[model samples]
Target chain A: MNEQRRDVLDLLAEGKITATEADQLITALERDQPPVASSSDTRPRGRAKYLRVMVDTLDDGESGQINVRVPLQLLRAGVRLAAVLPPQVLERANAGLSKSGLPIDLTQLKPDELEALVEHLDELVVDVDQPDAKVRVFCE
Target chain B: MPQLVTVRVTRVNRRPVRIWVPVLPVVLVLAPVLVLAVLAAAAACRVYRISVARALGSGWRVISALPGTQLDIGLGRSAVLVTIR
Candidate 1:
């Protein structure tokens, strides 16, 4: 164990702090540590494995959760598949998305370019907390 | 539950988006499934609706009305997940 961890344990053994306090300290220490790339990701290096979005809701003492894991490969294939669609279809799709307040233009997306973009977005995570719910979006 | 919705925003995109995909026909292909569910409900089959509503909660219901059941499928740049409890 590291010195910091040992210290926490020692304090616990001496009854200077409760188990819960020791646990909280250890958790805070872990949270403060810098992140290191680990083999646990199990994905091919430099390629995103999944796009994940999670939502947790708590209302009136009831709780619910959502977990979504979208494969990057599926997205890659979907992009390529877009080529088979007629141009008008793509145009109309973009128009419809804009009307829905999500103005995305697929025509400008090239697979390679999108791959590079995804590489950058792999580190992106967005979280929202409402009175009774939490939503998170990210890639892994 | 807190009566007032306290909104907290945290943007933590630690990973870069490596790919983006379009989902067009997925909608059309999925449409028939909904139509069938609707027809089943219209046919006086409360099984589908009851299960779905219960899952979404008495306030929450979902597919087949299975309680505490969840189904999540992710494809391309999008994902669809549903749960009922």
Candidate 2:
């Protein structure tokens, strides 16, 4: 019924596009439409406050567990601290991080970038399950 | 609004130990010393050509954001937990 759908149909009727191509274009348009919210789901959404990491491992019949919750504000402060750090210190920290397989550059961190990173982190969830170990990282 | 931190430690064959640390009282007690330290840090930052105000702001932010953090670790029969609230 939309203009795009009508145009696709017109192309099909004029033999410019095959029926299969018209159908594909309509399906693609449908896929691109925004999702409609359901009336039954109306929970209020709040900004995430903490980043949590949990690990549980079993080795040689012994079990160990670790849980850590880090405030997102702390992470923001840390980035601010990086801004005040000496250039040499940032360089050394970056070198050490790179040596440890993390190639992050602290000198390039900005408040805006940190905000974007936190926003993305709010939707991130990682889970790793093994026969004897489990690891989870998420935000809440 | 967090004003305290509770730490609990338990060991095998030993009773668990719990301690509650009041943050406000500690901060009040150390206020004078903290002021002097900050002044000295500011002087040092001037010598190093760093921004004293920004450094102090970041430090305060880090301290203020410490509340609501939690850590828990357990191994075998020993466990430790720390919560800020």
Candidate 3:
């Protein structure tokens, strides 16, 4: 038996969860996973190395250029943690941001929407070269 | 403080490179300003908390019911950033 399937049965045997809950968990796990990735295949697969944000900057007066790489994983974990924030805190945060005349409101930002945005962020490439400075922000 | 951040020393030039920018010394130099800013922000939070309390204050109470509340945010490799509350 598959490990998750077996684990569910074991939980039922130990009286840890109700049968209904076990069924739902098993169903969700089985249904939600990607069918292609889970299938048995000999093809080599490439895993994502990093969630990368690279910013290359240059200032005319500076001795050397500066390159900044922001790990995407940090952003990912932050979003996951934000999911646990209390609704009251989020509401208050929205009010506080509004008071500062900022358009950002955390309360209205949903996890799914944020996830979609993050996925799109991987495609962003920003490049600018000006007389004073050259700035770039992109995902690698 | 050191000037340039040294990584594993791969490529000296070209490609996207990650360099760490330390903000502690600058923050320390401006500590007094930061403290005043914090005080002002705290006062604002208190006012907001009170106004929010008048409506549905249960959340603040719930947070306070616990011994204490502390929020920490840190940035590092792989993890990038973390916030613990």
Better of 2 and 3 by DockQ: 2
- List of clashing residue pairs for candidate 2: none
Off by over 4 Å in 1: A1-47, A59-62, B1-85
Instruction: Compose the digit string of candidate 3's lDDT tens values, residues A1-140.
Output: 68888999999989999999999989988897667554326334333323433333333443334444444544554565465566787888888888999868797889888877776676576777676555566665
User: Where does model 1 sit among the CAPRI classes?
Assistant: incorrect
lDDT of each model, Cα atoms only? 0.58, 0.88, 0.53
Best by lDDT: 2
lDDT per residue for candidate 1 within B1-85, as digits (tens), equals 1111121222234332332222234446789896786666445424323343322232112112223233453333234444333
What TM-score against the true fold does each predicted structure earn? Answer: 0.40, 0.79, 0.37
Measured against the true chain A, the candidates' chain A TM-scores are: 0.55, 0.67, 0.50
lDDT of prediction 3: 0.53
For the second chain of model 3, what is the TM-score against the true structure's chain B? 0.34
- All predictions: root-mean-square deviation over Cα? 22.0, 5.1, 15.9
- For model 2, residues A1-140, the per-residue Cα lDDT tens digits are 78988999999999999989999999999898878677435435677899999999998898999999999988877777777888888899999999999999987877688767876786789999999999999999
Q: How would the candidate models be sorted by DockQ, starting from the highest?
A: 2, 3, 1
